[model samples]
Target chain A: MAHEHDPPLDPVFKSSLRELKWIIVIWLVHFVWVLGYCSTYGYLTPETPLITVIGMPSWVFWGVFVPWIAATLVSSWFALTQIEDHALPDASPLPEKSEADEKGGADHE
Target chain B: MNEGSTAALLTFAGYTISVFALAILSNRVGKGKDFVGEYFLGSRSFGVWAFALTFAATNASGGSFTGFPALIYTHGWTLALWIAAYMVMPLVSMALIGKRMNQIARKTNALTIPEVLRARFESPAVGLVATSLLIFFMFFYLLAQFKAGGIILSTLFADEPLFQSAVSFVSQTTVNIPWVNQAEPDYLVCLIIFAAAVIIYVVYGGFRAVVWTDVMQGIVMFVGVILMLGMALWQVGGLDNATRKLEQMIPPEHGSAILSTGTVVATDQTFAKGTWLFDTGKVFRLGELAIIREGQSSTVPVKILKITTPFEVEGLNAKRISGQIPDPGLTVRVTDPKPYKYGAGQTGNYVRNPGPDSGNDVGFLAIGTAISFFIFWPFAATGQPSNMVRLLSFKDTRTLRYSIVTVAIYYSIIYFALIIIFCCARVLMPGMEIAPDQTMPAFAAQLTRDAGIPWLAGLLVAAPFAAVMSSVDSFLLVVSSAVVRDIYQQHVDRQAPEKMIKILSYSVTVIVGVLAVLCVLNPPQYLQDLIVFATGGLAACFLIPMVLSLYWPRMTANATIAAMLGGTGMHLGLTCWGYIADKEFRAYSFLGVNPFIWDLIGSLVIALIVIAVGPKPNRDLVLKFFHDTTSDGS
Candidate 1:
């Protein structure tokens, strides 16, 4: 790949944004799965229609976990996507400057 | 010889030795600095697995297991609403707060919460207030941990006279001093365990060591919860059986019909009509009612003869004297009633007391489940001072992230398992005649007795000790850091050497240990209550200032300082007086108008007002602090 050194494109922001997106995607998939399971199973049981797996009943799984997964995914995506990678410069390693090499007069105090 | 005590002793000894050995091994292989980071934050060098485990350890304390479950058992499932509220907190934190905090800490070389606040606000006042709140609140919180540890010890070992006698024998043999009487040798042993744990990680490795240990402890905790829960559930014949048992044990009136119908109530009391009134004798009064009972006077009618009336009354009759005296009988009634009918509502309907069958035990599990979301999310993105320090001690963030994630998954599983197990305990041991807080430990003992699984019971009993030790060590490190880094090093004498920092940290740790011992010696009546009050106060003082300073450019030092002081004052004053008055106020009603809610509201309000009214901060400095991307580049 050609090393395209885009002046303002901050790599850190890009990576963080990418990470956030993936997390949201995973969270969404989980949420949808839960919602489908709860809704489908919930429709089946006539008396206690809520399908309870383990100790957590189906309704609780729907109400609590589904919403939580959805919120995590959506909110994280929104927050992460807002930070524009083009607005900031890449945070690659910079050449080290010793104390003695400063342009201004050294004022240790 | 109580089997519970014997099992508990063996379990405790095993865990202590294992933890100690782990600490020693980590120390031996790692450099002092590396060990410090690992101990505090699990070497922040952790892979996803370690990171998850550390997070679990930090979050899961005695509060989660004992206090939370006890609260649920006492209050009913309505308390689960709080857990739902908390689910959003971590996601909010990660998406909104974590990234910025992590970036800032990495850039500024801030190793503690106080340091981060100090750096962001550019005001010593903010730092001082935040540190003070942290110390004060954490002290109470730590005390709760200690007390929980003591209870666990007593529960697990109280009946083992042989173990008690052995401990007593050791104490007497080691230091044969005359006229020395220790109350409950088991309590002292708990104290020593906590003290030793705190000293090792804090005195030697600092934040880094604490984190590493936290990571390990967190994993163990997660696994422990899952294993125990699974075993309990399987023993009770799975979810169907468990639910059936719970239904049978719980009165028909107390069943959750609404929840059963796959609907969540907007309010907690929707199912109130289906539950029995725990307090049955109370008369139901709608809106208001005044009771006026006409009866014969307790005092016989007295004849009064005055000097002026003596001439008239003496000859004919006596004048009856009746004076209004204070009514001796107490009439209990609700003054201000809502739409809900009193006593007719479900057992969990009452805000103050949820009846025994209120399905409140489920609340703890709900909270545990919520906590899992934050366990290893974002791969340790926030880098909390303690957590960050651990990360820095690690070789790289990739390792930290991996360890954290691994631990997170494990923790989630364990947490879910614990919930299942605890609920089963509730079903199996309905109205179990033990202290509500000791329900879990007691149940574990019962299981051991019934099933003859000494090892599992022993392990379950020792879990609380592990929790206490992990939490206490972390608290000590944070407290010591505040003293060493913020106070002694920063304020008292600038340019303090590393040696001096080490010395100060150790000294602070020792002092805190002594204080903890003294505080526990004569614990107050409402220790847990006091802890909640303190946590609310601290959260109020710091959360807003920290959040705003991280995200907002206009947050000036003046505004931050004002918010810190104003918020602290408002929260502390309201909380203190409110507790004294024993009446809830509108201003105080945030999250049931608890002190924490009040503090959070007060701080946020003050911060906003200050930000709006005060002059904008130095824009150049703000940008340099917040947007300096190159500052973190190695």
Candidate 2:
């Protein structure tokens, strides 16, 4: 538990935040690709020949299913290989941040 | 009783019996565990398989099996895209918080979401506010689950011998009182039975019992849903045929079914006596035609009696399909009905059919709505109090990894499989104009009957029933814990004895269950809508505060309070406004976003801004949540 006054932030904790940023970025890009490219909504009207991939709609095959399969794989990778299982090192005092850094409070920076 | 009803009733009974046995078994096995911890959090002792299955079952409600499929049935191929967001739901929900949640939970011994928030911020009011909001929305969710159970039971046995005999017994034995008939709403009997079964097992077993039951039900639902999916494909020959069958291009008259009985039982869509039913290959649902009288306008209110049946029709590639329900059944009952046709196509270019929410012609609105929905529902699953309860009980980080894989695989199969099943259903059972929520049971019935194994239908019916029960039991526990652990024990009586706490926990669970059942007694038709709003409401309320509290160390108690109460009030206030102002508020979007998106966006923005500019929190509060140690480093 944190006391009234604590030591400087741990480097491991800061890196985890950095890792969180990268993960969110990767997933957000994937989300856009699935929605904008895979799904043919608003572009293909009802009159268009329903293109099929592996006997399913092209949008569903390429968009929803393919993208999700990738997502699941990536999620597994993150959970297994990427994330640090051990808790961050105890909050021992470290080199002090500059005045500007302290005011900014963006520790992950 | 007939074979179908008997099979259904027996399957349901078997499921209930298993639940009771599991509850008893868990209670017996829990000798060494602390009562409060064991009853509420399963002593924080769940393995990978247990964690994965319980998490999945708790999250996937009856809505997934029933209401979701109906949307697929109503909308054509586009429904798949509408739900594509789910592919990332498990990942987003578990990954960001997976490690932190498990570590911090053990560190603080927080039993509930409210407890976690309270300890993290060192503010009792945060706990109170969060608990109040969870209880408020979760009650509606619980009510929807109970009502969904009732609907599934009633619909599955509506024409079955067992249901008929039970109704007959009641109607014959009881006197007919004015206004309140003994056998009216016929769904009430099924509702009561379902409620009692759920309450008994949930109260008896507690968290361990719930998780154990979830594992069984999850497996049953997984296999049962897959079976229905396979049967649906087989009924339509293959996925290629299923898609082409729905893709057949026909004239506007093709939209209306050409009913041909000896006499036209329904006049709305019936054409001549000899020609084929409109020669339209595109059929999405079963058609219901009102039998009109002389000088009676189609617009005026009148009695509507339905007679629908699915029969073979030749479509593209000269294929025979049975899903086009063409002929009306009650021609003999109508008075002098003649073959007639009117009100052909409403949309001339409705070619590749769109799902209910997704429009055929993708536009800005469609893309925006899709984006909003993708974010909304997935966040709901991740941020739900019910799901959080399971996450808190996980034994270790390895369990989290296993849960992620399981959840991803599980949702991928179930969501995609449902789309296939209902799409095939469109080919095999179109013109079914019942309540949209009946899509699961209706499709399950056709899929099983077509497979020549009526018994499988019994188990398939149990799948959705299990789906609802899993969600209900979990939510019930969360609400009860919020009251007993977060509010009563924390605030009202901090010195409460352990014995008293155990009793209170059990009692609170019972009281909440009974109240939810009472809410379902006079069930409304739009319970699905209520469930959606409740889910969205939960996401709006908790997603912002919970995430920020963990990640943003600067988030003060004031910000947490603002986010919880303000977010909830914004959603509830807007929803009530929509209900009062426009009856069909779901159809209207705020600015360009759906109500859920708008609510979530508003709450999240407020939380972010407030944390950036709000009052500085106590040093201990931030240190406790963010730091691992203090000056006395040992």
Candidate 3:
């Protein structure tokens, strides 16, 4: 439980905000990467030869398929390595086992 | 039932029974915990597997399985860009507020989003408003899920004699009922069965059951997609071959036509909807069954197809294709065959950026719409109350961290694999546009049969079925919580007895589930559209307010309420304007951007302005939410 006299902006809250900034940055980067590449090369002229990379069209391979793989890696790194884990505050204990609490099968299987 | 249908039905029945068993086990697990918290929040304890799968499964609803595949099959490769934003959905949706909100909920011991808000501000009004908005949006969401469930079942059992008899009985029984009679007989029969099964399991099992089944369903979805991908790739030869075929393929044209049986004395042959037709070496698909009874004509819709590519034609011809063949003595004519407005008689459109559209010239996913979807997927996910509830249940931050990465990888695989599998579906099963939403299941049966294991179709169809069930259970629980915890317990009787609360919870779940089914008896036309509307509405109502409440210590109750109302008003107002303009249930996009973007902007601006003008939050509230109050003795 936080107190009135304690200083504002605890370590947990500050770290959360910092993590939020990084997450937003990641979102923006991927958004631009996918949109820019896809929109630029997705529309093609009939005379232009259809380019294939691996199995997918060059634009789709680079724009969506590849970025999707990269995103998984980047997100994994961020979640596992960058973000900090803090203990959550425990829930306030229930009233010392009222008669209703003592009799528990009301919510049946 | 045919051998294939029997196998599929048995597999589906086994899956459903497994789900019920999990529900029973979950109920047993709830024996000793606090009744309200255990049933509603799973005692706020979820490990990585449970948390990750539930979050992913709930988010990947019936739309992901049915609507997404349909779009890919209809529009071609552009859906890749349309849904590309999913790459960052995990980090953005989970990392943004998962930690902060979880911490807040723990401190307050809040079991619901509305409860969290009410406790944060000490305002009953806030809780009431939140509850009202949640139930409103989620009710519509539940309706869409029910409809999806019915549709999947109907498609699975279309060839079953027992199922056909049940449909006939249902149709005859409800023929006089105004709304019920309007629904398709198969859909109506399946809807009742789906509704009964879901309501019983969810009401009995509670949140833990929902989570347990979600884990199983999630795995089913993943395995189903991987298998389908393997079969599709194998059947289509390889990815390179499929893409090459797509490049040469031309988009089909849809139009209305009148089919006439000649005046000759010949028996009338019937052409079923979704069956292939041959006319002048060009292939066509019947949009509706044309039964020419005794020298009469039937006006029906048809899709004109041009499959000149010898490679695809060979595959089609190898199947010993079955379609109606008119007698040589009978004269037949098709009138008013409309050509595609865009990309008519053109090749290579399927592999291009915007892809091809039957109606729109700029393509199915224009630049503006593409950008809108890029923003829509991740951020919209963040604002969902169902996702928020899952975030609150993790055992610890480590679980959260691991779950985020798991979901990111999970979505990347499922989405990318689906796009590949369905794109290959175009080559294997051409002319699915007659019933596009059935593409996933229909293609699954076809692929499995081709692989000489028709029984596997059951497991594949269960993927979409599981998706619908997972979503339905979560939404059902959410609505029940809102009613029982937020409304009845908090406002009606804060000290309601445990037995009463339990009974009320069960009753509410059943009632809400039944109401949603009844509402969907005459189902909506587009599943994806309804999902978009409900999700967008909820995000609009809760996202900004909840985010500000968690981060800004000075955020006032007045501002939170204002932001919620303003966002809801903006979203609905724009949707209404869209309906009037287009005469359809779609949102009006200003400047080509979706209504969600504008609604979110308006919501943020409103919240900030209100926070600036309104008085600060109560000092005690700030200390409770923000400061380290453990050090300062109250």
Candidate 4:
């Protein structure tokens, strides 16, 4: 069952778990805030209008804009973290020598 | 300037600005080696959140906003229950499909969904079948989005044909076609918008860029829908006022009979006499004289119905009680049918019109709201090439999970608000029946006319273009990756230079863009229906094999291949036959019995049977794939 191609797991599983915990906590905080705001301030139908925010209404601000901004921030944070954690490491790995190199350089040359 | 011209100008400008912005962003970010791999698969490192957002963005597409709303308006709110299927999808995807697929994909370095199939089954035929199905279905789905975009454009800029003209001119000039200019300006404009956005992103950034942009666009879409909904509600006074007006427009009696059917009761038994079985306490009383006799007629019900000691009244004492029976249990009186005009001589006649303005269609709204809440939320995550790339791009799973949870909450709110607003629009424009495809845009236009909020209307119109273009760009990246990476470099010439891959990518992007444009030119009457048909087919064909291969040790390669072929073949056969056959044979009901449901069911059944009937796979290999307890401990 063992395969040589199987990737090695870094011993950082614990730290990774810790980092995930922080992310979930922050996300939960924001989620709660959004839910509270939507429940309290959201205009369920068109007839129950709220005051304007930058020519847009309060319902728009709370229901749409607020959640959007929160999601963007969270997503951006995740993206930045991902670039740091995953892509950077893999990109920097030593480029494997091809068959041409083993045969003493390019055959065409 | 006319509303059409203004809207067109805004739409064209918005798309141009966004695309340019995306291009600059991609250029600033270094283009890595393994361009196809890095760009399309994000090197296969996508965590939960980015994966979720990218998935969400892909699923949201043009149909979510325009098509679904139009359906809600047409069918009434009861149809919204169909969306309940969505909530279950994510749980199924994450627990059943996504985690396993991620494992296999990472292990095999499989770039596409089809690649995963190939690796699992070790069958080229399986790969080909899966790839062909993916391409075929995705193309139809993409075309639906294109059509949606076109409809939005036509409605938003009804008068000015400038954007449409530009699209036609560009299509003709680039592809050497003289006849496309004669097509509808809406279709032309949508085609050009999609072509430009997709070509640039796929050509430059590849998959990485597409995924990143999906995350961004997903955020924009979530916000845009919400803002549109809020603005809509504001125009109709407010929620309370809108509800009141809706009540005035549609009486309670006119509400959906199907919903009320759940509340009906037979009035036969003595204990239940005069009382609706569904509403027990109000209609019949056990101790009191509940029924009254008319003239010389016998007093029907003076009974001790069931209040502990059941008994019946006899003789003179059973005489009918006169006058007001205090709180005579609520009688759900079934009213007569009221006929309403629909499309071209079609009349929607309801048997029990609750009242002149009973908002019965609210059931549709409720159902739509529920659908938007769950199933639609997860849809934002499926079959997106750019999203897969983004997930692959992620540095770790932690970031991905965070991104998913955030996007999920964001999606939930935005969709809920949008559905509410559309339901509100139903009340505001009771008799307004623009084309189903143009429902949301027409509503926006009406708001502009009624409320003088051109800016808001313009934004609403632009939203679909943004949503559709984002999806189209992701699809372009996918199609291009398949050609450049999977087919050309990998299969045709393994030693092909990076330059060739880049060239192939760009060339494929352009070609696909052209094809997409051609498809959009001959648009379907219902873009939403087209999208569902395509995505449902994909889900049926891929869902089981992808999941079982990753998770179940018993899923043999033969079973996997069989499931895929069986699912895809049955789906296509049934769908084609349904579409082509005569009316009676057409098993294309909207909810209870439809081609999509049939396809999904067929695929699930065949896939299960194959798994059970076929020989078991190497259990140890399956476990290694699923439960490899290793982490890059760096």
The best candidate in terms of DockQ:
3
Which is the better candidate, 3 or 4, if ranked by lDDT? 3
What C-alpha lDDT values do all the predictions have? Answer: 0.50, 0.68, 0.84, 0.52
Tens-place lDDT per residue, model 1, B526-558, is 776676565555555666676677656667666
Winner on lDDT (2 vs 4): 2
CAPRI class of candidate 4: incorrect
Model 4 residue runs over 4 Å out of place are A1-109, B2-11, B44-52, B84-95, B161-182, B248-393, B448-451, B524-529, B580-601, B608-620, B627-634
By lDDT, the better pick of 1 and 2 is 2
* Order of the predicted models by TM-score, top scorer first: 3, 2, 1, 4
Instruction: List iRMS (one decimal) for every candidate.
Output: 10.7, 9.1, 8.1, 12.6
Isolated chain B TM-score per model: 0.72, 0.84, 0.95, 0.72
Query: What's the lDDT of the predicted structure labeled candidate 4?
Result: 0.52
lDDT of 4 by residue, B460-522 (tens): 666666677677777776676666655664346767777777677778788877787786676
Return the TM-score for each candidate structure.
0.69, 0.83, 0.94, 0.65
Docking quality of model 1: it rates as incorrect
Q: Candidate 4, B311: how far from true, in Å?
A: 51
Off by over 4 Å in 1: A1-58, A65-109, B1-4, B29-44, B72-82, B85-90, B166-185, B250-411, B580-598, B628-634
**Candidate 1 chain B minimal-lDDT segment of 10 residues:** B300-309
Report, in order, each candidate's fnat. Answer: 0.05, 0.25, 0.61, 0.02
